[model samples]
Target: MAGTNRILVIVTSVGEYEKAGYRTGLWLGELTHFYDVAEQAGFAMTIASIAGGHVPLDPESLAHDVLADLGTDKRYADREFMDKLTDTVPVADVDVEDFDAIYLTGGHGVMFDFHQSAALESLIARFHETGRIVSAVCHGPCGLLDVTLSGGEPLVRGKDVTGFSWPEEELARRADVVPYSLQDRLKQLGASYSTAEKPFATYVVEDGLLITGQNPGSAKAVAEAVVGRLR
Candidate 1:
């Protein structure tokens, strides 16, 4: 990839799930795994959030078991990498033309804020209309809920896609806490949604320039799919 190949990473700024009384933000592995893969592929990357400044991390995502399984301990300890989370560009300030791709990384926090940001929806729409790749993993697809194209059609309508599944949410015991089931919302928006029979498995789908991952475990696969398209 050339130096001009740039990617914009969208993370949730919602620090806590107010209704559930739990601290939540971006899932650490979701961002780190995707970032590591894209960066190593030679794409310059920028981190941005719904709200600028420090981004919260879902505490559970940093738990020992999760970190060990994801094999991201070194990234977790990277001071420079971790610093990027401390401050992020506000979505409103992002120039959609500068990025070749827009990646939405997820955590439960996204369920609350991602889908509600008009600025993000506009950015995604522009990226889509301009022939850039639009990708998301886990609850990050929540951001796609209301994006409308230039023709006023819902972006996900009639598109084959996948995201955090309803069964996965219920399995994680967050079904009631999350604002809504992401899979259900995607289906309601006319996206053809599907996922692995097993929760948290690596499952990625690409429909045109749109790429999506089923869960955090699918982050790298999703990034690779984007890289494949870009190449």
Candidate 2:
């Protein structure tokens, strides 16, 4: 407790596409990668979903090729980490005061549920208004779209932020299936959203206490930025 930072990680509960077969929950690497980086820096983490209970991973994020790219397999293999995902705290049950920051992880599934939850939006607002770090990576920023501060201004209004971009979504082939363009929606909400020049390149933007990363490739960097800020 003396030198530790408690991070509240908000993951999505809905693993949609059940009808079509495959499911999409939080992107595994987005959470695992960030977890590895932050935990290594001595930060404590709590994984939670809007509806609580288990939260799955986007199947593709753990594919052989992806596992070859990200250092997430270890987290997947670690029983302690997997256990956390197996049973997560519901967002409504979380007390903003217990943590120093809130990190929203991403997946296509988040496109279905993250933005719609009023409870999550309220916590995001509370985290920001209290001068705590509010961060997200990839589709994670979707949760920030509807959050309004106690002052009544959109949390991201005029904020320089970056999230999963239209080009990246199109490249991932989920452009047609996704509910809306995360980049476009954030811009419409008055966020000055931008992206990396390369579709999947790592990109992160830190504006005041709100930090956002461009895609899965940027998760660890975003976590590192949060670590630096917390210090």
Candidate 3:
């Protein structure tokens, strides 16, 4: 069981940078979905980000109602596991080959940095070339914008995928911080994206090495699908 498939979970590190900036990162449920399942499946997991330290969290995602009914019961009170999130592998310094698959977790903050990261783009490209599973959910799909296959085609082009929809983006704008809409950009990139009847409802699409989920609510299903493909 030496190399029983290592999973690299990448969380967004960007927070608001202007005056009175608050810490903002991944959705709490997004991280917990795969964390609970991957650990049980015996896959070694490493939490990482575009930068190496202090991953933030969207305040709304931590509401009692959101965590109370998720698949994992103890995700909220697990302090030790929560501490692991503090230390992250800088995408610029890590070797993608060390991981068997990569899962990008989402938050509104990802829109600020994930798409523009050259280091992350390179890592994902190598992950794709090696035939490793490259997965993401919600705003995390922003990271996919920079990934190009060996033929120079955007990895998501012609790939069936879904992400934070425009309607959901409008809703979040009414309630929280969101820099830009992932759905608009993905569509601009020529990705054939679709969604569920409700914005936050669970919806997933698996096209070759890419796997995507519609919103935070779909994180668990997306994680399950990634695990299924890896198996």
Q: Which candidate is the best by TM-score?
A: 1
Q: For residues 1-231, could you state the per-residue lDDT of candidate 2 as single tens digits?
A: 525689999999988763455678888899888988888889999989989999978888879778766677777778976888888899999999999999999998888788999999999999998999999999999999889888888999999999999999889987767888999999999999888889999999999999999999999999999999998
Error (Å) of candidate 3 at residue 74 is: 1.9
Put down candidate 1 lDDT per residue, 108-181, tens digits, no spaces.
99988898999999999999999999999999999999999989899999999999998899988987887778
Q: Between prediction 1 and prediction 3, which has the larger TM-score? A: 1
Over 4 Å off, model 1: none
C-alpha lDDT score of every prediction, in listed order? 0.91, 0.89, 0.82
Q: Any idea what lDDT model 1 has? A: 0.91
- Evaluated at residue 61, the lDDT of candidate 1 is 93
How do the predictions measure up, each by TM-score? 0.97, 0.96, 0.92
Model 1 vs. true fold: TM: 0.97
Instruction: Give per-residue CA lDDT, model 3, range 141-186, as digits (tens).
Output: 9999978878989988888989889898777663345555677778
Could you tell which candidate, 1 or 3, scores higher by lDDT?
1
TM-score of model 2 vs. true structure: 0.96
Residue 200, model 2: Cα distance from true site in angstroms: 0.5
